[model samples]
Target: METALEKRYIDFDATGFSNEELLTIYKKLVLPRLIEEKMLILLRQGKITKWFSGWGQEGISVGCAYAMNEEEFILPMHRNLGVFTTRNVPLNRLFSQFQGKENGFTKGRDRSFHFGTIEHKLVGMISHLGPQLGIADGIALAAKVKKEQKTTLVFTGDGGASEGDFHEAVNVASVWDLPVIFAIENNQWGLSTPSREQFNCKQFIDKGIGYGIEGIQVNGNNVLDVIRTVRSIREKMLQDSKPVLLELMTFRMRGHEEASGTKYYPEGLQDEWKKQDPVDNYTLFLKEKGILTDALEKEIHDSIKHDIQKNFDLAQNEPLIPAAIETELNDIYAPFTQHVIAPKGDQKEMRFIDAIQDGLKQSMEKYPDLIIMGQDVAEYGGVFKVTEGFVDLFGKDRVRNTPICESAIVGVGLGLSIAGMKAVVEMQFADFVTCGFNQIVNNLAKLHWRWGENADVVVRMPTGANTAAGPFHSQSNEAWFFHTPGLKIVYPSTPEDAKGLLAAAIEDPNPVLFFEHKYLYRSLKAEVSTDYYTTEIGKARTVRQGTDLTIITYGLGVQWAEEYLDQHSEISAEVIDLRTLLPLDTEAVYAAVKKTGKVLVLHEDCMTGGIGGEIAALIAENCFEHLDAPVKRIASLDTPVPFAVPLEQQFLPKVRIDEAVKGILKY
Candidate 1:
C-alpha cells in the first residue's frame, strides 16, 4: 500500500542535475543517515543519554541545505541533523555535545539537539517549539534592515505549526515582507500524536493563503524535488522580499527518541516507509544513472562509517563536563564601557515621556544594531505618543510597529538579541505584559545563566494605575519578574532618572525590564540632560532626607510620600526611591533604617505577595539590630483594581502610607 507521498517521491525527476551532482547529493543523504544510526548505537551503549533520529527525513534537510547560500541563517528543529552536518558542524563536535563533553558548543551546559556555532548562522533549537519561528522572523528582519540579501529558513514539526508563535511569526513576515521561509517538516507524528490529530487543515501549506504568502508542498523523500522547490522559493524571496510556506510531507519511521518504540504506529508502517528510505532510494537512483558503481558505493559507505567512528572515539575520550555547572556560568553579560557625556548647555526641562523618547533616540544613534519594536511604536507614534517622532527619525525598519501580540514582541526580541542585535520591546501597558510572560521569565531570563549567552533586551513597560483604566489595564507587575533571577528590573520615578536609566539599560548586556509609570508620563517635569549619561542600575536615590522615620518606596509611591511630607511638616521621614528592584541598594536601605530606627515599605501592588514584603524582610534581616521599631509594610489591598475613582485611589493604599508613617514614628 504505497501512500501518495511515497509514490510521488518514487517518481520524482532529477532532470536538472548532472551525474556528478546526483552522486554528490546521494552522498550527502547517506552521511546523515549513517550518523543517525551511530547516534542510536551510542544511546544504547550509554555513551549518549538520548537520541532523536532524522533517519527518514534527511532528504528535506539536505536538499534545502544544498539549495541554500551558506550566509543564510537556519533555525532548525531537533530532527534536522542534516542541516548541522551540511553547515560543516564537525562530527567530533556534534558527538562531543551528545556525550556531555567540555569541548562541546555549550561546554556541556546543554544537551541533545541544543547546540550551534554563531559562525554558521545556525541557531540551535530550544525546547519550546514555536518561538524559533518568531526568532527567524527577527533574523530576517535584521537582514532586511541591514540591506543584506540573506534569507532565513526556520523548521518546525507539524504539531508546532499549531503554536501561537507560528501564527505570529508568519503574520509578521507577511506584513513586513521579510525574507523568511517557514519550513514545516511534516513528518506525520509529533511524539505520538499524528498530524491529523494535531491540525484540521487539508495540508499545512493551505493556511499560508490566509496569511497572503505563497504556499508550496513537495514530497519529503525526494531530494531533487526538495532542492528544486527550495531554490525557487529562495529566488522568489530575494526578488519580492516575501515569505513562503514550504511543507515537506513525510513520515517518521522511528519513535520520538531511541528509548521509545514504534508500537503505537501501524504494524507495517515502518517497513513500508523504509522501502522508500531517502538514502537507499537516492543511492539506487544514482546507480541507475551509472554515477554510483558497486565499488564507488562501497567506498562512500565505508568512508562515512569511518568518519563517524573516528568522531565517536574522540567524543568518548574528551574531558567529561565538570560535576558543578557554576564554573562555566561566568560572563553572563558581556562587558561594555560606560561614560557620561556632559549636558550640551543648561539642562532642558521636559516631561518624562519626552525624556524617554530622547533617550531612545540617543541610544539608537549610538548603537546601529539597536531596534525598537512594539504595537504602535512606528508610524502611528504609539498609543501614548511616547514614540511620536521616532519613525520619522529612525525609519520604520528600526522603530517598527508590531501586531497586538505581546508575547510575540518579546519572543522576537529575544531572537534578535540571540542573533547579536540589541532590541528594546515595549509592552503598551504594563498589565498586558502577562501575555508574553513566558518569554520574559523562561527564555530571556534563563539564557545567560544557562548557556553563557547574553539575552540583551530592554522591555519597556508603561505601568501603574492612574488613568482609571480599570483592572485589566492598571497593574504594577514588577513583582512577577522580581522573583525571576537573571533579570534586571528598573522602575524610574523622575525624568532625569528615566533618561539616564534607559541609556544605561540600552548599554547593559543583560535583559532589563524598564517600568515607566503611566501616571508620570506627562505629569513629571524636570531638567533633563541633553547629553547621554547612564544612571547606574542597582542604585537608589534619596528623594528627601529626614530622621523621624524611613519611608522606602518606588514608582507612584514616591509621589505620594513626597506630597504627604510636604503637607505634614512636623513628621520627618527619609524617602528612598529604589530605581532598580532586583539589585536592591542595601547600603542606602541600611543607612536609612539605622538613622531613623523605624522602617515603612510602601508600594501600589497587592499587599500579600508584593515587593514590599521583600523590602520589609531585607530591613528585618540586615538592619534588624539597628531597628528600634518593627518594620511595617503598606500596600494595596488583595483585590483587583476597581473602576470607581475613589475606590481605586483608596485601594492603592496611598493615604495608608501616611498612617503607617505616623504609626512607625510613634512606635
Candidate 2:
C-alpha cells in the first residue's frame, strides 16, 4: 500500500527533511481527513446541519499551509479543510462553527467554511466560489504596495476555474506581477461534469501560459511531492513577486456533498485513483520509511478523533444564536468622525465635475493609503474626465486603472479594503454595474455583515440620462443598491454636496454606492471650498422652506423641483433633498411630511421598484394620521431611457414633478 511516487522527493533517502518534518506533514494531512469523517457521521445523525466534504483532497491544502509562512494569507474554498486545521485555527472554535454555535467565527450568522479568521490570516469562501480569487489578488496587491514579502495561496475547483472571476483575477494578477499562487484542484468533476467537459484546455496549468505566468501540475495525491513543490515555489515567489498557476491534480473520492452520492458520476471511482488515496497511501508511505508506525498512526487517529468528538458534543449544548440580529446591523459599519464641512476655508467657483475631482484629490491627500481604480480613471481621467489630472497628482499606484471586469473589480475593491486599505471603484456608467451585480451585492455589501469585517470602499456610479447615452449607458440604478442593507447610497445634485459627499463616502468605513448624475456633472456650478471636508451621510438637506406642500426628491428631481417652483413663486412648495438614499434621515422626512400634511416623493429612476416607493411607504406607515393628502410618487416612465433628446426629456421626471406637485396640492 506504500504509495510509489513518479519520482522520489529530493533524494531516495528524503535528503533535505528530518524524521520530525515528515511526521508533522503526515499529521497535518491526517487531521482534517479524520475530522471530516467525524463531521460526515454528524451530518448523517443530524448533529450538524450540513457539510461540504473535503473527503479526498487533503494534500493540496496541507502542502500549501505547511509551506506558507505564518504571515502569508490562505484564501481557501469549501473543500480545503486542511487549510484551517493546518493553519492552527483552534479546534474548539472550528468544531463550534460547524455545529452552529453562537461563538463561532461568524457568531452563527453563517455556516460551513463560509467565514474568515483575519487573526489567523485565513479568509474563507463564499458559496459563489470565484470571487475569492479576486479577493486574494487584492490582498497580494496590498502586500506589494506595503513592500511586504508575502504571497497568497488561493484555491478554486475544476468548476470554479471556468468562472469570469477566475479570468479577471488571474489576468489582473499577471498584469500587475502580484505574488499569488492560483491553485486549482482539478478534482475530475464539478459536482458531476468531468474536467474534460468543464474546460477544453489540455491541463489546468495550461491557463498560466495565456496569462504569461509560470505553470506547474503536481501529483496532488502525493503529499511529499506537494510539500516540496509548494515550499520551493514560495521561495521563488518571494524573490520575483510573480504569480504562478498550480494545478493540483486530484479527485473527489466522495460526492460533491453527503446529500448527493456518486450516482451522478456515471463512471464511479476508477481503481487507479482509489489506490492513490491521499491519506491512506501517505500513511503507508510513512510506515515504510520508519517515519510512522502502527502505534503512532493509532495514537494520531485516536487523539484527533477525541478532540473532534469532544468539541462537537460540547458545541451541541451551546446556546443557539440570539434571534434579534437586527441589533448588530448598526455596529457593522465603522464609525466616522471627520470634518463635515470645510472649517473657515477660502471658497472658489467650480463646476460639479471639478469639485468631485478636487474632492477625490483631497481624499487621497488625507488618506495616503486610499486608492481609486476603474476602466480609464487613471490616464483617461475616466469617461467624464472627473479624474482629469489625477495621474499627475497621485502616482499610477494610487490612481490605478482596471480591466473592464466589473464583478472582479468590485471584489478586488472589497479585497483591498479587507487588507486595511481603502478603495474606490468607478463604474464607467451606472447601467454597466449590472455586469458586476453579484459582486456589489453579495461580496461587497455582505462582507461586513457575514465576516464582521468593515469594508471601506466606495463605488462611484455615473448615472442619469438626457445626454443620449441610451439605455445601456444611462440608468438611475441607485434603487438597486438602496434595497440591499449594509450598503450606503448617496446621490447629490449640487456642486458643494458633490464634493462634500464624495469625501464622506470615501471616509466612511463601509461599502458606499455614490451615484453622480451625468446630466448634473457639468450643468451645475457654484462656489466650492478649497479645503478638505465631508458632508454627513444619511441626512437630508432642506433645499427650501414653504408650507403648502412638501416635495421630496433626490438627483435630477431636486433641480426640476427648484426650477418649477422658481417659475411660480406663489406655489409655496417646500423641497427636501435626500442626498443619502440609505440610512435615510427619517426624522427630517417625517418633520416635512407633518408640517405640510401632504408629500410628493420623486426621483428620475423608473416609478416601478424605485426608491420613491420606499419613501412613500415610509411616510404612509409612520405619518398616516398627520397627512392631509395621500402620499404621491413621481418618477420617470417605466421604460428604457430613450435615445432622442425630446423623448429623454419626457422620460425624465421634470414635467411629472411639476404636475405631481400641482395634483397633490389639489388633493
Best by lDDT: 2
Off by over 4 Å in 2: 1-13, 267-271, 335-343
Tens-digit lDDT track for model 1 on 1-667? 1122322237658788887788888888888988987877777777788888888899988988888999888888878889988888888888888877877777766886775567777777778788778778888887888888888899988988888888988998899898988999998888888877888889988999999998999988898899999999999888889999999988888888866768899878887787777777776666667788878978888999999999889988877766764564344434455565445655899999999988989999999899999988888888898888888788888899898887777877877786679999999888888888877887788777555667889999998886798998888889999998778899999998999899999998889999999989999899998887778888899999998988999988899999999999998889999999976788998898899898889898999899989888888888888898999999988998887898898888886876787777777
What are the clashing pairs of model 2? none
Q: Any residue pairs clashing in model 1, and if so which?
A: none
Q: Using alpha carbons, what is the TM-score of model 1?
A: 0.94
Error of 2 at 627 (Å): 1.2
lDDT of each: 0.84, 0.85
lDDT of 2 by residue, 365-467 (tens): 9998898989999888998998878999988888888988888788778878878999989999988999888888887777777878877889999999878
Instruction: State the weakest 10-residue window (summed lDDT) of model 2.
Output: 4-13
TM-score: which candidate is best? 2
Candidate 1 stretches with Cα past 4 Å from truth are: 1-9, 323-331, 340-344, 418-420
